[model samples]
Target chain A: MIVAFLCQNCAQGAANTAGVQRMRYSDEIHIVRVPCAGRAGAREILHAFNNGAEAVAVIGCCFGACHFSDANLITLRRVKIVKKFLVEMGYSTDCVTMYTSRAAEGDTIVGDFEDILERKYDPETPPCPGGAK
Target chain B: MVRLSVVQLRGCERCAWDLLTLAKNSSVEFVSHPLIDGGSGSDNDADFVVITGYARKSDEARLRELLSRGKKLILYGTCPYTGGIFGLMNQKGADVVPVTEYLSPVASVLGCAPSPDELLSVIEGQSAQRQPLCSECERHFTDEEFDKIIRVPDWSNREKCFNNLGLACSGVLSARCAQRCIDFDTPCRGCVGMVDDPPGRMIGYFGSLAVNLQVDTVATDCATDRLGDRPDEITRSLVDVVGTFFRFHLASHFKFPGRNPSTGDELADIMVARPIEEAPQIAATIYGRYGISVALNLIEAYEAAAGIQVSDETRELRSELRAAQDGLLTALDQHDIEALEGVIDKIRTIGGNEVLSNVYFGGFKRPVKSAKNGFDTYCVGPLEIKAVHARSEDGCSRVSFSTDEQGVIREWSCELRSA
Candidate 1:
């Protein structure tokens, strides 16, 4: 399963908009609404992978939209650490990613999920638990 | 006679020689020295087994055999204890490991090369009181005086403290080891791994410092306020503080390492063999917790020491930062800014009230007072805290709180402007 950590304000709201608009995406993604993108950090990211998350996405508010002053930047930095660790320790870098978006853009979130899921069907890589539905 | 055996792992054999040359007692019997008498690895008869150098994948069998012997294992230097210089191979995938994970030792006599007398003291059981290396030759300075500190200093003045000179002396951050470097006028490189996480402490401390320092001194437009800004700097500075921090620029300002050389396919395929749980721990042991993958760039380093993940248990302040992080990620991640901010405020209240109580006004009952005119001061450990507020006829009111420890107004304190 893909564990999607969505910031409740922007990213989660974007996901909510997709839900409200009935925008369809892959069923593999399990949206976890966190207060902000930075809430899901190293431990949480690793924990998701350990619990069988084929991939994890941390989506935060767009730049300057974060009320706490650039917390998305903080999330971006942490995502770097976890991603570096995944690669250096011989884990797939494809398993993790980060993004910033607005609440009105439901289609963008759906598009991101589609792009992520299409990789499962990509000829370059082997198929895993997060299969192409 | 105490049977002493030496196991040379991966470092230069100076620590072993220091033990032998410094031993004046006739009561200790030398049973095996791999370089000298050359006994095999599985000797259980020795009362004291000294292991020097960091462990490598090739040395696993011998290390496990020696550890399995149930003898008193003494980690003889920085390499064995903190993975030493040879551990730099970790990012390269050579698989260097610290002896700390192998077994607890009778004593960890750590240093790049400890003075000859240290081994003698450990054998004699003449244990000295444990304290920070800074306390041995510390020179105190107030908050403002500290900012004037520079990287390099006049070599002539050996009496002065390196930290006071603004030299990033590892002594201040390290535990009381053999004061070998301190006495020799070369500041203490972190030969002994600190009891607390070194990289986190260094970045956090320097982050706070970078905040108070003039922006132009460190950088132009970029501001990296978080702790782990330079992954390469953290790894390089592990045991050699002087090379990375002091005598050079702040370690944060040091260049990040060139990208690690691992192919994405090679990474994905390897996980089939190594479990996910071991990945974090092994990486942590390698540098995740040790050197840490700090700031990706100079801008990120100053942007948010808050940007990096800090899990240091020793400091109460970091705990608050950790608490605030959840609310921040929530606050910053989404569009409902006001509600998420409320979550952050509530967390600060819980954290602040845990430490602060009874808001003792301290004899200031005026119409209102600015922070500078009527401030109350108190001490927490080595830090001195100052706070100010205005009170009504009933008592002190109007308290503002946030998790910014650096802000003139934070936690229990407020930037009480004139009312």
Candidate 2:
């Protein structure tokens, strides 16, 4: 299943907006709210993948717009680190993605989810094991 | 009361002063016999040992004797942690000793001469954590003020960041030196020591920051001197970005030319003689730790230095193919036959016949049929392809090719579409 980490202030608001707008997105996506995307460490993202997330996405505030002042930059760095780790571990680098969204862009969140679903459903790729302890 | 003894193996005794100051201010008793009489500290019966500077062959015996005493070891300077500036003697065949060669220290305070406060903190049984220079100066300026200064600052504005003034501050990668030099309206020279992550993470952070601030060219130009003579224009450009990134910590982190496996002089000669070949390897070893971005940047830098050039035609073709791929993705998402056909025509013009065949075979799960006239295309899901132009030398030829919805090519003919 696709797992998404949404920043509470920005990304989570967009996720809520998408739900309110009744935007159609894949049911395979599971959203996890975080205090800020910066709070999501590399280890935590890797842990989600290790625990059976077929794909992972981190949604945070746009550049230069982080509520915590440069915290999103930390999140961006963490995402890059996790993506590198995933590649080294023989996983598809496309398995993880980071996106920036404003609270008003519900359509963008749904579109990003759709993109994740498309990547996850590649027929050539085998399913990743889920429920990793 | 903890009994502490300070040992100066070789080189300058700068950090010894900090240790002494720490002893005078704290409860730790200093064993002063070694300093007064040139005697070894083994006779002092100290509870803790603080060793500074690079140990030479002659100092090794004394170091071994000190290690044998089994006192808790704390290497208190950059010399012990990374062999320091004197460690450069390793290039000239001098035997320099790093503390790692003998015993593992309980804690290491890594600085040219660590701050007095850091030494005191370690002596007080506290962890001496390194802070980036930015964190130290945050109290003096707010986030908005800092961002404004970094993003857009007056060139003559001396009280703000020195980096904006075209100075090689290295404040981002260095430990907080209390902004002493900056307070005097002078730039920091990074004498304090590198941040905990050193060149890798520090490079990425600062490189991105420089890019954001649009001062990358100036920042890079300032860092080029550290790269030595072998650096080409590409290497010069990146030296500021990556060379500056790992300047202080290069010796400590990666195995370089003048290091143990190879002598510094020998490595220096090789780099000077065969820079294009050897420089990439050195750059790779240094930037590889940071991640793919730095590695890719190094590759581009090396390619540029080596005079490897990609033709504009090829570059244009690559971008066209990329755009076509994006178009194909959009077409698939929207199930638009017209959009798909437009992308197919663009791909055909760009000689993307192989890519089209692969996309059809892999993406659409179709058995593509190729012929002299045209490609018999197949469709899955919603849209259906009637025909696609294959490679042709003479020009457009009318050819009929068809495929069923099940991705089975019914009739095939390979032909080019006329302009």
Candidate 3:
């Protein structure tokens, strides 16, 4: 399965650290680093889903530990609202998920992605053109 | 035929960008002039003057004088309506030299700018129209096959309440624009100025109604910054302050605790004394509470009513609320006082007050007493505050109260009016 991981700040830094250490991770997992998870608006998420990615996850800093103060909380609330919208648009809830991880939780992040990939997902629902998912 | 003249005021390329798009679709003739050129001295011949950006009071006066020569006008973009970002500096006190300095809400002030769509609509003799496309919806208003859509009132009209206008139509920058801004994490400065008919009256009239009705909360969206943080002078700082005030002009002028540009009304005193009124309605509609309740009830009914079907979740929430209400009524009828008390305690835990009180009411109060008359002043007790409001453009709040045997409210110390 094609999996995309949108990582913000701490998560992104951790990915870099993993990369520097030459830590082995699944080649299928693509990591995209962003300034803050909150900056990833609903449009961006929907855009990814519309494109080729079979599943997507937003990795923000752990609640209250965001580098930009309340940025993580804002993103969390926004993701909830966007999830509702996505559900109404007929996308499976399983396809989109939010993951909070500290910089040290690199192994956990990769492990969670592996577990999520094993779940059954419907391929029949056509993706929206230019939407994230 | 609406004769039109387009002037580039003080905005980014958005207004001009949209105007070019408009020029392609309509019969509008382009009256080209240098950006910030004001006018080419041939303004009197134009029928409709379309200003493309925010303008300072000086620019505003020039524009208004030019437009006033028997011609209609449209201000394009947030610059015209709320003066956009450029108006933010108005709060800092920068432009014109003044005798007595003050800040003012410019919603009603002449030469205010508006968005291109707004200007275009005005030029066409139709009221300013908001953006037709909802980003959430792929189709624009013109593309929608449906007819007879429910249209909301304009934001600038005084008749509509801020709450009743819902999340989209009322307040600043058009409801849709406001909601979009919020979605994008931006605050609306109210560039639209309550777009309904019969432009809204600022604090003076609304405040009078509030005092007369003894309403507690005005569902206040407007405020004045007398807090030392406010810039000392406004007239001189017109250039920077113009656009920001334009955005919040409606809230600023109509705000109960604000200053009027002309008469100098103090809105805070009205805010302070509101708690003193018996049965003061904290939340009121159109200066009273009925408007909000009616609007909310209507929305609920619309959602349930056959014509307007609400989401399953909303319907479920409504039914749940009804069931809860029924249960409470039955318990009350059965004399389940303990159960009722428990429920009340639960509500209190959630921060619901038994009866709202203006516990923290009073702010600073300034009287009209002159300095020549020594500051000594005395009055009776339990004074019945007759009316509290500000005069047009003067920006001072007027509190008229009847004295009990001795004047009570006036008993407080007075200071000399500075020249």
Interface RMSD values for all candidates: 11.4, 14.9, 22.7
Candidate 3 C-alpha error for residue B338, in Å:
66
Best by lDDT: 2
lDDT of 1 by residue, B1-419 (tens): 67788887754454554455433556766677654455464456778888876775567677777777788888787778766644443333445566666677888776655554666577778763456776666344335324443433454455566655555556657767643345433455465545444533443343333222322111111121112223432222122222222211111111111123432322222111222111211211222101111101111122132232222221233233334434434443343346444643443242221111101111111111111222222111111222222111101112222222221211221111111
Cα lDDT tens digits for candidate 3, B239-291: 11112222334222211111212112121211121122211112111111121
> Pick by TM-score: which candidate is best?
1
Candidate 1 residue A46 Cα shift, in angstroms, is 8.0
Each model's TM-score, in the order given? 0.46, 0.38, 0.30
Candidate 1, after superposition: displacement of residue A26 in Å? 5.7
Q: How displaced is residue B229 in candidate 3, in Å?
A: 46
Worst lDDT 10-window in candidate 2 chain A: A124-133
Which of candidates 2 and 3 reaches a greater lDDT?
2
**DockQ head-to-head 1 vs 3, winner:** 1
Top candidate by DockQ: 1
TM-scores (chain A) of the candidates: 0.88, 0.88, 0.75
- TM-score rank, highest first? 1, 2, 3
TM-score of chain B of 3: 0.33
In order, the Cα lDDT scores of the candidates are 0.46, 0.48, 0.34
Q: Provide the lowest-lDDT 10-residue window in model 3 chain B.
A: B356-365
